[model samples]
Target: PNDALYFGFGKPPILVPKSNAIKRSYSLTWPEEVVGALVFLGSLLAVRGVYALVPFLMALGCAAVTTFLTLKMWRLIRARELSFYRFNLKSAGKLRKAGWAFAIFACCWIGLNAHSGWIRYHEVLGNFAFQKIQVPDELALAQVNPARWLNSTQRENILEGKKHYDAASRVALFVNSEALPKLAWFEYLLGNAEQSIQLLGQAASYQKDESKALSLYYRGAILNRLGRHEEARSSLDQALAERDDLILARQEKGESLWQLGRRDEAVAVWTDAVRRNARLALVNNELAGAARSLGKLEEASAHEKQADQFTPNDPFYQWMLGRRLQALGMSELAEKHLRQAEQLGAGDGMPNER
Candidate 1:
């Protein structure tokens, strides 16, 4: 009879006066619904970017909150029979259901965070791998002194850079746009001007703004040297457009203009170039020669002195000063400078004063 009463399998043996038993319905309250929705939304937002730590932190926070809520739900389940526990079995079931929902949500959140973290880890690893590839120091030294680069027999170092460049190309995440430009310079030192121009163009295509301007500047200078004045001028114009303060491009553009017989335009360009960079010895020398040809002897003398001040040890500058002094009838000073020029290996007669 006790088992029947407890299990509700049959009617009780004794009956007493009945009291009213309140019936209650349990559902999600507004506060609980809002909290659950916020957690779900936050988990989705956490994995939105490339940063790995953000998602990991979000997962940790969610897991902590979910664990706390789950423990509370477990305690409520355990005390369901206690008088102090006002919630019925149906309410306990709802709490358990909510706890499970939070656990599943946390697991999903953690999984997304882990996937993002893995991708970020690979990105970092790829960067480290790229840094580990040894680049030859001579590659940088070569930029300062092409003659020294050409005279160097460090074939192994050059080969190493080439090997690394190839390896970097194979990796999807590696980004070294300057690599081809450096290689182009090496090829230029090797007397491969055509290949250098091609490589520089490739490098420029991969770059933007100032870097692209610099690559174009080099291409223009090389083209100017090769007597391709039109193409050189076009490249230089593009470079100057990209970076108006690129004094080297301005100087090279002037040279290209002079080569194409636009003397007045060339002089105007150099005037602007020198105005921007007064210490530019090459422009000063060019302006000096131009002034002398136009019979502006005083102006020529002034520019020649400026060039001497800027680059006293340059063989070409010594030769230009010697020529200017010779024209001015300062025979002794001209002879001294000419001798110095010869000693310093000014063997190309004159550098066109460009």
Candidate 2:
């Protein structure tokens, strides 16, 4: 029949030649993968500085990158063919999985960011709370137990105090007289001797009464520790002038004098110090050594006995006494003290005979 065989459809679809048709393949190249990784890293680095200010934005960026990487990993795992680099998001199931993963990651990132912010807020509040505490209370607490000042909580309070002091200083020309010494003490405890010394000087300059005596004494003590014997002696002399009853200042002054090669003067200073406070083991110990050096054996022996009596349980004192006795040729007494020191875990190793 003349009519051509026709399908139910109005017209048949046109078939193009295979050689003339265009074919497209979607796949990530090695260079593209590397660039993606670099882009992710670069974004993180770029946002790090601003993360604290805009944590939500930072978290969003991170979540987006995480979602992308997760999707890529899912594609890799589900790929049937080897070397599969294309990420397919056309499937409803795959799209839903990606959406859920992104949502979960974003939630976690936001939660973590909120937690970090909360911590920072609490730290700031802690600082403000510490700043509100009365200086006298803090000082009395520190003085009551000097070791307490070295604890973490006290150290944090001190650091916060310093920050507050700095901020206040920017609006004023002078430091608070009472706070100066406390700040110096904080610096000393933190192992910044130079800064402590500088702060003490400021305190001394701010006040010249008996109140400044403590600052002067601390300055002298730190100078002695630093081996600036002349400066320490000068500072201690000023401290004594400010408060004549300062036995500790006298003891430290003698030490500085001894270091400066004025042995007779040092002996005199320590003797006076011991008389002022007979129970002071430190002064007694110093007097004992000074008397021994001056060939006053009887005086040395008396002071040594006094020191031992005052600090009976002190291992360092026992070790020092043993050494002095050993030097004076009292072998039995020396051995006894040395053994006591050893039992108390004082010396680094066995006491050496000198």
Off by over 4 Å in 2: 1-157, 312-342, 345-354
Which ten contiguous residues of candidate 2 have the minimum total lDDT?
Answer: 137-146
Tens digit per residue, CA lDDT, model 1, 173-269? 4344656676676566545678778888888888889989999998887776566889989999989998999998998898778778898998999
User: All candidates: CA RMSD in angstroms?
Assistant: 15.3, 19.6
Full-model lDDT for every candidate: 0.62, 0.63
Which candidate ranks first by lDDT, i.e. highest?
2
Error of 1 at 22 (Å): 46
- Alpha-carbon deviation at 2 in model 2, angstroms: 99
What are the per-residue Cα lDDT tens digits for candidate 2 across 150-256? Answer: 55676776777666545544443334566567667656655677888899988898777687888999888787767787998999999999999998789878877
Give me the overall lDDT of model 1: 0.62
Q: Native-vs-model 2 lDDT?
A: 0.63
- For candidate 1, the per-residue lDDT at 64 reads 55
TM-score against native, each model: 0.51, 0.50
Q: What's the lDDT for residue 42 in model 2?
A: 43
Q: In model 1, how many backbone clashes occur?
A: 0
